[model samples]
Structures are given as structure tokens and as C-alpha cells.
Target: MDDKSATFVVEGEGCEEDVLKWYYHGRSGRPNKNSGELSSKVKKYLSIKGWVFRYALKNGKKELQYQSPHGEVYNSLRMACKSYIDQGLGEGRMGNVDPKQPKKRKCLSIENQPLLKSVQSESPERRNKLKKQENRVVKTSKRVREGPVSSRNPRTVLSLLIDNNVVPMLGNVYYRNKTGPPLMKGRITRDGIQCHCCSKVFTLTAFEDHAGSTNHRPAANIILDDGTGRSLSDCQRQVSDSMKSTTTTLRTRSVVEIPKTVKAANSIRDENDGVCSACCGGGDLICCDYCPSSFHMKCIGLKEVPDGDWFCPYCCCGICGIGYVRDRSFRSCHQCELKFHGDCLNSKKPSEMKTEKNTLLLCSQNCERIFYGLQKLTGKPILVGNNLTWTLLTPDHRAHGGHGMKSSAKKENQCKLRAALEVMHECFEPSESVETGRDLIEDVIFGQVSKLKRLNFRGFYTVILEENGDLVSVATLRVYDNKVAEMPLVATRFKHRRRGMCRVLVDELEKNLVKLGVEKLVLPAVSTTLETWTNNFGFSCIPDDERSKLVQYSLLEFQGTITCQKLLK
Candidate 1:
């Protein structure tokens, strides 16, 4: 039998009795404003009690709708689980779930049942089917004050059912057929509630003060249309209008981008560096219609200027799946290889969580957590073979009480920092003086220096390669959103030279860099070692034009060094 028929049979015992009771009186059946929320404990308890169907709200995402394992969605856990059992999709296990990123929730007091902000779901046709069956089961309990509720946004809208008409109810008050019972009688459903009225359905445009001037159906529910001419009648206003409306709005639609364009006279702006993303050179450049990236006519192979707006190959917004059209702003994440509009990100995430949005290395909380996870692995030895060990260090490692470090561990980290400082000073002395050179090393390592100098080393990481637990080589590095990285200093203990220790150190650093999405590694190769770098190392000299673009990085440079780069991917 169909689910509707089975539900109405009143089987008088066991599971069927439980389902009937819930259908008649549970939180979802006769909702009093819980915003379709179910407590986590209740969900788990239902699952432990052998309710096979389940739904989960995933974290660190802006996507709509909580979905079950079999891809079904519903308003509550008990109802969803029961539906799955009825449909026979097989049972599911609550295996491993990633910890949810903490977020502040806004709530409303009900004077009855308090409600959190609604979880997203669609009013599937199953709801309508159940509602129709429910009209037969509980005719007296099915009726409620019907109208176009202004305060409640609903998932399913009430519209004329004949010929698939989409226009909705127009007025604030509604009535059922007085003769007896209307045919397409609305009722409570397994998913949500539904209600209907006798007349005044419309196929024209606008809501509230709007006249039916056009046959336009708005993409949003803002404009409810009215085909019937009766705007004024003796309809009494319902007091339920002041209460929170249980109505669902349209099935969730993608956040739309209506690009705020510059005036026609001032279409393209020079806000980004006037250079090609391909060659990183300045010239007569073609700007992306959406983002700040520009490409030169030759570099992009455009023989003629396009007649309309042009977006770069990288103009797609990861959040919306929409490519840049005209005047839209977009930024790409180095880690996820995803592009997002600044406004789209702002709409989903809280404004206080600025680190992920501001940094290219991470575009979401999941990525932010990943980077921190990688950081935690630092200051710990990673073994390579029996003899070699790789260790990473940051300012936090050497800082007192860092991430709640004990005093002894803090002292140990300080000792290691000082030892690495001695080795750096031994290998690369300053052109000016020994003390000045040592000061630069100490400042970069400990972050006790000029703000501008510290900015270059904002996220400074020290890579060390140890042979049999002896520090052999070290490199000082910084990465910017996986776009590019700069290693200002590379040094090997004099005794450890010619043993390929520096190469091993570099290889290890590159492996981690790839994981972090660093695309290229640029080094300021001192003239004495330039040939060795270009030949022994896999680096090529950066052209003068390309070198100019590197100015934005504010990379550290010395008088005798020529810049060299090695692509990571």
C-alpha cells in the first residue's frame, strides 16, 4: 500500500501506533514554531532506537538543506527516518562526522516553543500527497486561518492547481468553500503543512500596492499576482497574521549576483596591478569583466578586442557556479582552486571571522582548520629514512605559553631557535657588519623587528634538515596564499656542505609547499651562487618585467642577488 493509505489505517499497536501518534501530535505534525529544528540528542536517540532514516546538517559550508545518506530531505529526524524505513532505502550508520566549526546562532523566543533560524528544505510533492490524504483522515483538525501570510516565507506557495498555474494568492484573508468541502482540500503533510482558499488566484505581476500590469513572474516571491479583480471585499482580518507564520518560502535558490557596474564612461577600473596574470608584465591589457585580473592582447591570444564583456578563464565563482559576466568581483583560493565573490562570502559567513576570507591560503573554515592542523605538526620531527629528520619551526614554537606550551617545552624551543640562528649567521653574513646581520636573523626568527621587515616574514617558517639528529641545513621562507613563496636565506653548516644536505632540505620544503598549494618558489640568489642555483637547482632567472610584478610581494632582496624562480606545479 502507499504511505498515505498505510498512515490512515490506524493499525492499533506497536510501530504503526507510534507513527500515527507522531503524525497527529508531534513537533513537525502540528508545528508551533520550532523553525523546523530538531535537537542533536533527539536525532541520535531516534537513531539508537533503530530509526533507519537520518538527516545531517554539515558544517563549514553555505549550501542549503540538510540531506539524508540516501539523499532524502525532511523537516525532522523522526519523520525522515520513518520515511526511509517505509521506502526501503536500507539502513544507515552514523559513522565518522567531522567536528562542526563553532558559529553563533540567532534565535527567537516563542512564548511557547523557542525556534532557531530555519534549516533549509524543499516542500517535495510528497508533502502535497500526504496533505491530500490528511484532509480525509482529519477533516475537522485540517482547517486553519488561510491567507497570504505576509510575515512567513514558505517553501511551497499556494497557487491554482488547474493546468499547472504558478500564480499565488493575492490578498491577506481567505475562506474555504461555504457550500460543503472544496475538492483539492489542503492538509498537514509528512514534510510540512499546506492550506488553500476558495477564490482570487492570479496570473499577473506584483504584490501589495502593485497592479496587474504585466504577465511577469518574479524570480522571487516579492511580487504576488492577482488575476481576479476583487481587491476589496468584506473579508475579516485574522489575528494569526501577527504571530510567526509557519509558511515556507520558495525552494532555496542560489544567491543571485546583480553586479554593481561602473558607469558606461568609466567601465573598466585600474584597481588591480596593470599586468597580465599569465606573463606578469605591464602593457595595453584587457581587464576581466568580473575580477581584477587583466591579460595582454598577445598573451591572451586575442587578435581583436571583443565586442562585448570578456572574463578570464578563471572568472567562475565557486560558491554560485556562475562565471563572471560584467563588473563582478571575484577572488580565487589557492588551496581549493575555487573562486568566490566577496559579497557571496559575506552573506554566508559571519563578519567577525576575517582570517579565512582575508587569506588566499584558506577560503573556508575547513581549510583554515587544515592549515592550523599542519601548523601543529611543526616543531615535531618527521623522519625520512633511518638517518634524516625534518623539522619545521614558526615564531609560535619559540614563544612562551604558545598554544598553552609548558615552560620546559618553551625553553627547549628557544634553545632550538637560538641554535638555528647561530647556523644562519655562520652561513650568510651581512654585507654591512656581523652584528647587523645577526640582528636581522634574530628579528626574522623571533619577530622582534621593524613592522615592514616583519610583514615580509609575517608567517615565517624555518625548515631544517638533520642528518642523524645533527642540524645540517636551514631555509627561511614565506608563502602568500599558495600563489607564490619566497625563501630569503638558505644556509648549510660548513662541515655539512657538499653532502646534498641543502638539496634534501629544499626537497622536503617543496613537498610541504605543494600540500599548501604554493605554485612557485622565488629565491634571491646571491651572484656567487647564481650559476649553481640556475644549474644544480631547478631555478630559472625571472625576467625584468616579471620581476617588477614581484614588488607587490615585498620580497627580501640583496644588492648582489638576482631573482630566480622554480614552478611547484
Candidate 2:
């Protein structure tokens, strides 16, 4: 080629062979290839290394030309192939090449001169940005070279232990003192301080004074390095001895006598009057069921009269001393409804009981078993379903055994109840009235009736059906005083409805109500089902004017527009 059109070339004739060898080595274990395949492979390899190959005229001869994006051209494939391989090997792309034939060190070549000059011709703004980036890299490297600095102040107890090089045991007690080693070892206790060495209990001040006394000796030998030749344990002991002597001198000078005014104030506070026990005077007082003393509701923190008789803390026998007034934590005896602390049931602390307010806390376990036995005698299954069983549950059952079901079983039952209620209200009740009825079931039937006494409302009796231990249906019956009762929530699973399940539940409930001397049954029926209820159950809708007649029976507060009553002769 003429000098004017000649392109740079590597000083080798087997340039194509060298490129093929490198390509095959990189993609080893691939199928063998012919001349055409070698040409195609080399083109692909060069393209990946950011070099493009094209057939172009050089000095009137058509030859393959290779060019980089940075504007360097080569007519000889050998030089272009060498440049691509060098860049790949330097960037770690050519893996595990023969180390014996080490790669030549990269140097600024004549072909790279154009790229360097182009970079140097950049605008001042761009150059300044590049310089700023280089400075940031240097700052970052310096930061990495320097190690982290720690704070002098210890923020937590764990940090303090770490700083002192003290390995703490689970039950080890750490003490802070003004003198000596600053921290002395002791034992943790429920009531007060206990000395680790002597195993004696003492108040906080007494323990501090005793621990720093000259007679005090190390409870256990601890190896410590305090940067001194002296034994750390011996040095610590000497410091305590010096502090004890100094403390004795200070204590003698600070001693003072009790003032007469302070003594007189204490005496007046301790003196008791022979009137109402809590406030020394009575306005409206509630007499304790077990004690002669009476306490004003306000004095004892009682907002309202208890549903059952009240017992003074002194008279109440239990681990929880005289139960606080208005404290719902106090459980009641299932049989008597008399308040007692849960701990009193088994002489266990509140934490150990693991029983809820609804859990039956009987006077004794025997009473609990008897209550269950009574339920077995009186209660019966009312609704049956496919692979399902139903049983009646009363508040008395909950008071004795906590929900009359296991936690998992209770959750399953609640889910079934919620599902059944949702379906029944949607199907039977008006759209607007559905929410009201649901609220009644949620707030009254399921929520409060079983746990709290509202007005003359007695308690809730639930008939729940289970299929293979999963709840499927539930019907809630609310009993009221004056021989009256109301059925608020009666529902069966959608799959089990119209199968006489609800009918069986109501029939069994009616039989039980008769046994309990219930003379009348009040049912809140939807407008759509009023006629069916009236015809099938012999219920007659009470006129709006007659709603006042139900005030005494508490039926006047019913939310449904149609209040039906069935007289049970």
C-alpha cells in the first residue's frame, strides 16, 4: 500500500491464527470450526471489545479494517487483534492464560495518542469536574486507611461492662459506688439488695456501706489488668478499706436526731377512727361481704356498685392483697359470683395463673369439676351438621373454664359465627338495617353479654355446632329477668342452613327456657321474615304503642322494627 493510505499493522503475518487461538482458548470445549467460522468468530470477538470491523479500500486494495470508538484505525488485523487481547487480559476477561508467556505491560502507544489528545482538548468546566472526581477518590482512600475512633462516654449498661473488660453472668449484679472500684458485685433479689459474699439481705444504703468496709473481702477472685504491676484484686480491696474508714468519719458528723414535729405527724396519720374504715366518716358506704368495715365508693376508687358483693382486701384471702376496687383483674367465684383475686383460687401469683377474666376461678378445683358436671347434666347439643356436633354454652361455663373451649377452638367458632352472621344479615335483613343488627350482635351478643351484666340483662347462652372440631354454626340466647328471654343472634352455616339446624337449636333452647321458668320469648325479626316467624313460631309482632309495655322486660330497646314475642304457656 502507498504511504498516504497505509494503516498501522502488528509486525506479524499469522495475525488471524493468533486471534483464532485466543478465541478458542476463551471459549474452550466448543465445536471445531472452518475458515468461514473463524472469520465470523473473530468479527464477533472484536465487536464485543468495542472495536468494529468493516471491509474498506486501502491504497486501491479491498481489505478488512478495524476501528475503535475513540477513532483509531488499523488496516492489519494482527495489530487490531493484539490491541483487543491486551485490553481483555488487562481487564481480566481472558481467564487463565499461560502465565509462562506473560502479557506485555500496557503502555501509551502511537495509536492511543489521538485518544489522549482528544481527552486533553476537553472544556475547562469538564476538566475541572474530572479533577474534582479524582480529588474525591483520594479523600475516600485516606478515610479507608484510617481506623474508626470510639467515644469516651459509655451510653448503656452493656457498654459500661465492655469498657471495664468485665464479662457479666446472667444473674450477676453490678453496683455503682462513689468510692472503691466504683462497681461492686452483688446478687439480684425480688425484695431488696443481697450481698454476694455473705448471702445476707440489706437495704440499699446498708449494702453500699457494708461492701466498702475493711472487713469486706472479695467474694470470688477476678483476674484484671489495670496497667499496673500491682495485683488488681489486691488494689481494689485496699481502695474499699480506705473508703470505709473515710465513710465512718463522715457518718458520725452527719448524724441527726428525729424532730418532735415529724414524730407527731406520723402518730396522727397512724391513728384510726372507729367509724367507716376507709375514710373515718360515711356518706354512702358499701359494707364488705366478709368484714364489718364499710368503705365509701369514692374512697375505695369504685365508680359503680359491683354486680356482686364486695370483699375488703384484708378479708379477701389470696396472694393479691385486698383486691383494688373497680379492678377487673379480680376474678369471681362461678357459684357465688363473689369477687376474689385469681391468685386466691390456687394461691398462685397473678403472673403464674395464666388465666383470663372469663376463665372460671372457683373456690377450689373440686368446685370447678362440679360446675362442669352440672353443665354436663343440664346442657345438651341442639344443632347437628355433617361431621359436626353442637353444644350449649353458658356464662357459668365460661366463668369456670374460660370460654368453654380451647383458644384455637374459640377462634374457629368466632370465625364461623362471624361468617354465618354476615351471610344471614345480607340475606334476611334490609341493607341499611344490616349494619345495626350486626353492631348489636358484635357489641352486645358476642362482646358484652357473656362477660358483663348490662341493666337487667342476665347472661348469654350459646349453642355452637362443630364439624370435625371446626365450628360451623352458632345461636346466642340472651336471658333477662321477669321470666323473659331474647334470641338476638341465631345463625347456621350457609351450607347447613334450611336443613332444620336453626329449628333444632331454637326448639332445644325453648325446652331449656321452659325448664328455667321463662314465660315469654322475644325475638327481633327482620321485616321480610316477620310473617314467617309469626306463622311458624306463633309469634305476634307487638304494635309500636305496645312497645312501652316491654320497658319493664327491657324489650322496648330492641333494634329491629318487628319485635315478635312467643308466649310459652
Write one digit per residue (lDDT tens) for candidate 1, span 1-569. Answer: 11221111111112222332333345335663432333333344334444433222345322222245555556554566456435532333212211121111111111111112221241443221111111111010001111111111111122111112222232322222224432222222211123344232321111211322232221122211233422111110011121113211111111122223412212223343233444433334556555555555555455645645565545666556467663266665433335677777664451222232243335765445435555666777777655677888766532221343544344334444655765665554422211112245555666443222212244566777765435667788766555677887787765556788888888888887787667889987655577988899899999876775554354655433578999996
Q: What 10-residue stretch in candidate 2 is worst by lDDT?
A: 137-146
Q: Give RMSD to native, each candidate.
A: 34.0, 33.2
Off by over 4 Å in 1: 1-370, 397-404, 430-438, 453-456
lDDT at 190 for candidate 1?
15
| Candidate 1: Cα lDDT at 135 | 12
Which tens-of-lDDT digit does each residue in 1-569 have in candidate 2?
44343344322122223463555444454455564555555566556546666566666887777887556878665566666666663254454344223222211111100011123654554332221111110000000001111112212222222233442222345344335563555653322345667777543334556666442322222222233323223333343345457756764553344355544522312322112332223233455554344444454565555655566543453445455653546665543234565545555322112346534445544344444443563334443444445566553324334535543334323433443344334223211211111134433334343111211123455666544333345666655533467775565544444667666567756776676566788876655567868987688976655543443233313222456788886
TM-score of each predicted structure versus truth: 0.37, 0.30
Clashing pairs in 2: 313-322, 360-399, 360-400, 388-467
